[model samples]
Target: MLAKRINGALRHVPAWPLYIVAVVPPVWLLWQGLTGGLGVEPIKALEHELGELALQLLIAGLCITPLRRFAGVNLLRYRRAVGLIAFFYVVLHLLVWLVLDVQILSQIWADIIKRPYITVGMAAFVLLIPLAATSNNASIRKLGGKRWRQLHKLVYAAALLGGVHFLMLVKGFQIEPLIYLAIIVGLLALRLPLATGARQRA
Candidate 1:
């Protein structure tokens, strides 16, 4: 089968390369900012790009299970790396916003309280902290497989809030953020057992 062939090819592909490749983007973005490539508002552009990349990674992570179950394309091996990189991007985005954009701690706190999108984004970031902290064999053994799976389910909520945060932050009827939110909702819907059962037929 094609999936078997793909899986075989993927077997030789190590996860470590993913980490190395993922590092390139942020480094490139930083270089761009320094070189006047990210435009006048370099910090804001950096933050926005990182946040969007994080959202895209979240979407890709959500697709992994569905792809394996429905299409027989097993990428379970790289899921952890993808998830960790996504969390890293999320942290980078927050740092750009906090350290570069809003240096004042009090103002940052006030913005988190006053801006609905920032609140939602911050909530998503909070949800990701534990997941990022425990993305390893040690944490899996410490928490056990079942409990760890339960804890990681928080990714769904984080992903949803990320989409919503994007939608809320953009003014007017922006199609891009709307598409992101719709894709997130659709991916979440695919996780329902009923959806699986229906796909399997009556």
Candidate 2:
């Protein structure tokens, strides 16, 4: 069954494009950083870019199931890839802030502790770490389906936290983060009715 599924996924889409597409943004960032095209403060640009990418990827990951269900495309196969990429962006976001912006390890730790936005962002990223770690089929099988599903539900919290982080990160409360927040809420709300109905039936 697994082999058939793997073969079907490979036939459905080529993998190389996905990999290449994923690397494009970071490569661009590296080039910009080297060329000093990232404004007066390249570090700030790097931090902001990474955070935006993380948020964008988080939005994409949350949209996968809804898009699949609504469009009847069965693109859940791409969910893990989307999620892991999101996780990578988040790691980049945090690392740039820690290494470039904060410079001092103690300051970075203190910033995470003191700043509510950073605190939420770090929480979201930490939540993603486990999800990314268990993204592989082997880990999924080892954990069993039920446990795996439960663990993955952490994505909801991570998404919510990510949106909150962005909302707080903005210079002022902006519509962009609110829009992302609404989408996250709507996607999550879409799940509850069915789960509730199933329980009522049982």
- Residue 164's lDDT within candidate 2 is 86
The CA lDDT at 180 in model 1 is 96
Candidate 2: deviation at residue 45, Å?
A: 1.5
- For candidate 1, list the clashing residue pairs, or say none: none
**Per-residue lDDT of model 2, residues 88-180, tens digit only:** 888888888877788998888898899999999989988998999999999989999889989999999999999888889888657988998
> How far in Å is the alpha carbon of 176 misplaced in model 1?
0.2
Model 2 earns a TM-score of 0.87
TM-scores across all candidates?
A: 0.96, 0.87
Runs with alpha carbons beyond 4 Å of true place in candidate 2? 1-11, 194-202
* Candidate 2 clashes between residue pairs 3 or more apart in a chain or in different chains: none
